[model samples]
Target: MTKIIFKEHDGKEHPVDVENGMTVMEAAIKNMIPGIDADCGGACACATCHVYVDPAWVDKVGKPESMEEDMLDFAFDVRENSRLSCQIKVTDALDGLIVTTPEKQF
Candidate 1:
């Protein structure tokens, strides 16, 4: 399992162990982590799962592709590091990955 840490806008931290092949959004939902509504499931059709990848892991997490980039336009407070959690696959390389949730999902 790869451990990932999610930091909420309020500064709350939720660390979870996610299985390989699972998306960050899946881990958040499974662990009941607040701030990730994931209304579109993992389809990348919505931005409810938007998150800011911590600078330390940004290169590893990479940038959102066309579909995800388009959906991010609807996310609140989008930033250069903003990413749809559903687009991030969990792998050993992502262990200790950190991401921050926006104040609201909108």
Candidate 2:
């Protein structure tokens, strides 16, 4: 399992154990982390699962695809490290992944 740290805008942090092959959004929602709404599940149709990957882990998390990039544009407080959690698949290599929740998700 990978240890994913979800940091909220309010500075609250939620650490969750995510299984390999699961998407970051799925892990957050399953663990009841208060950030990613995942309104469209993991279909990549919604921007509610938007998150800012920790700068230190940016290279490790890699870049999002064109479709994910388009969805991120509609998210709030998007930054250089912005990513759609639903598009990020978990793996052993990303065991200590850290992601930050956006301030808003509408």
Candidate 3:
């Protein structure tokens, strides 16, 4: 299982065990992490699951695709490290991935 750490805007941290092949958004929603609204349910149509991938793990998490990039443009609090969690697939190499939720979702 991969260990996913979700840091909220209020500075609260939540860690969850996620299986490989599942998307970051799926893990968050399954674990009840509050920040991810997942309004489109991983269809890449909504940006409510927007998050900032920790800089240290950027290389590991890799870059987003053109489609995900387009959706992120609609997200609140966009950042250099911003990503749509639904676009990230978990892997054994990403066992200790850390993601921070944006302050708001719209």
Candidate 4:
């Protein structure tokens, strides 16, 4: 399992142990991390699970794929660090990944 830190808009943080290969959104939902609406259930068809990858971990987490980038066009307050949690798969290299939710999902 990989450990991921999810920070809510209000600055609350939730640390979760997620199985390898599972999408970050799945872990958030399972752990009841607030701010991850996951309206499309990790389908990459919606942006409700939008998050800002911690700048320090951006290189490790990598950028969003084209499909995710397209969907992110609909997210709120998108920035250089913006990403759809559903598109980020867990891996041993990603242990201790950190992501922060937007003030609201779109």
Top-lDDT candidate index:
1
TM-score of each: 0.98, 0.97, 0.97, 0.97
Backbone clashes for every candidate come to 0, 0, 0, 0
Spell out the clash pairs found in candidate 4. none
lDDT of each: 0.95, 0.92, 0.94, 0.94
Among these predicted structures, which one has the highest TM-score? 1
Ranking by TM-score: 1, 3, 4, 2
Per residue, candidate 1 scores C-alpha lDDT tens digits across 1-106 of 8999999999899999999999999999999989999999999999999999999999999878999999999999999999999999999999999999999999
Between candidates 1 and 2, name the one with more favorable TM-score: 1
The deviation in Å at residue 56 for candidate 4 is 0.7
| lDDT comparing candidate 3 with the true structure | 0.94
